[model samples]
Target: MNKSLSRLESALLLVAPLLMLLGGVLLVRYDDQGWDGVLAAMAAHPARSDVGWLLVAAGAALTVPPTAALAALVRARRPGLGATALVLTALGWASVPAYAMGGIVMEAMAHAPDRAAQVAVLEQFNDGRGNAFFLAAALGAVGYIVLAVGLARDRVAPAAAAVLIGLGGAGTLLVMAGPIRALLLVAVVLLLAGQAWTVTAGRRTAPASAVAAV
Candidate 1:
């Protein structure tokens, strides 16, 4: 039963990357824009824009399960792993506000067809609260880092998965400003690849003793 459960957890973890991949693809195909750009496009079409919001919501929602899988692995291994996972999970959850704000920002951008509203949105984006976006991105990068560390330490997640997560996180965090933002853009691709690998790998079983306890 523990083994079966482990496999189930692995399966759930894989979903994270796959959904990211799909979302990335949609962003590229639909708007030929980055994720934020896509959201902006969607926001531009407020009434009809709900479609894009749905996709954004879907992508954001998919981030949770894999994070949970990471937490599970941590709990199974280290004594204080649960606490660490919870802290990281809070960071993961922090992205919610960013995602929400991005949606609003996008919606505002959509209204930009009218110069006045566009100016208002631009001002809002320039304010200190605009930092929420950076926070979201930072949280995402950190979450992946924590997830990778947890997986590697627990021996449940793949080494390649860990590497990819780390790489993605690093890529995103370091070059988040200006044209370098393109590097961060590429992180999305890496994230998708890591997730796909995670999902496709063979599932493993936990120890018999652990299974009985669960």
Candidate 2:
């Protein structure tokens, strides 16, 4: 059962990143209209909006499993550091659903007859002033940083991977600044790739007793 569970987690970790990457690609590909434009388009084509939002939500949801798996793997190797990494990663990832779900809200707002109201809602959402927004951003940044450190210290993942994750966390500030928005995607890819490596490495190195205990 433990081995089966481990395999399941590995599969989930592998698939989740691919889904997220696909979602990111879709967002960029379809984003030619920008947020306001996309919302307007979505308003006009409800079906397309539904599909897009669904994809986004699915992608966001998939991120959680791999993140949890990463924390678990780290915990196995180093308890204290692993605990810290898990807490931070959990906090950071907790905000992903909200961020992804914003697409659904935006789609609904698009249907509003009053264009001005629609714009107002979009602006407010974009402003990022809400408590949830702050919580997600703060927790995500700090969590990734801590996770990266733990990964490096424990030698569970490559040093480069840890650096990339840390850089990605720091890069969020730059994203808010409006330049190099793509950095987020790059950071995600790095972190996911790193985690994947760790999972594979763990499977190979785990003792039979340890594997059975899990």
Candidate 3:
């Protein structure tokens, strides 16, 4: 791919995550962990719920290319670990469509005429496929952690940055409170800095290693 294109995509990866996180925050505010809460929120703030879901879906989709490029760099140095990371990342991100569908369902639920209709929509989503969402989300967290570890092990990235990446990814996944997720900002700064160091190192020695990864 073109170098400029790669850079653009990397920039997208950096920014797109903010959209997903912001969307998540929006959803959290409305869905008070119950059907009644969801119906109420939808009745009161349906538009906000719609925007939140859209942002999350768009952000997740936009990051795919950049994440793939990052995985390729990791693979170039260590094939086995790279393959594992790629699989995990791909599988984890596979939840994107499911998430998108979730937004539609929420909308449907919001427009539902009554509590019983809303319950039906919610229950249908609670099917076997629903179980996969949790697993995929968890895998995505682990995937980023593994990718950072592999990059560091292959000497393509700073070990400290990799460590920070792992911590940030894990922390974001484990923390439930809305405020605590602000750790994402700290993580992103370290991520950008670490990626910058990796690119500089690659340019100075092995240019191929960087591959314009952000």
Q: Highest TM-score, which number?
A: 3
The model with the greater lDDT, 2 or 3, is 3
Candidate 1 lDDT over residue span 1-214, tens digit each: 1232445555544554454434333331222124345445555456444443344345556556655655665666553654565465556545543444455555655544665555455456545675665565566556556767766766554788767866764453333322332454587567656655655654463743676789
The global C-alpha lDDT for each of the candidates, from Candidate 1 onward, is: 0.52, 0.57, 0.60
Top candidate by lDDT: 3
Any residue pairs clashing in model 2, and if so which? none
Ranking by lDDT: 3, 2, 1
TM-score of each: 0.64, 0.71, 0.73
Model 1 Cα displacement at 38 (Å)? 9.1
Q: Residue 121, candidate 2: how far off, in angstroms?
A: 2.8
Model 3 agreement with the true structure over 122-196: per-residue lDDT tens digits: 666555656567577678778878888876775555687567655554443323112343554454355445544
Over the full model, what C-alpha lDDT does candidate 2 score relative to the true structure? 0.57
How much does candidate 2 score in TM-score?
0.71
Supply the TM-score for candidate 3.
0.73
Candidate 2 C-alpha lDDT tens digits along 1-214: 1232366766765676566555554442223225567666667766554554455456546656655655565677667766776676566655555555665666677777787766665566556564565566576677677777766765656677667656654343223212243665675576566656656554233533576799
Residue 131 lDDT in model 1? Answer: 64
Candidate 3: list runs displaced more than 4 Å.
1-5, 28-33, 120-124, 169-214
Residue runs of model 1 more than 4 Å from their true location after superposition? 1-16, 25-50, 93-97, 112-117, 169-185, 203-214
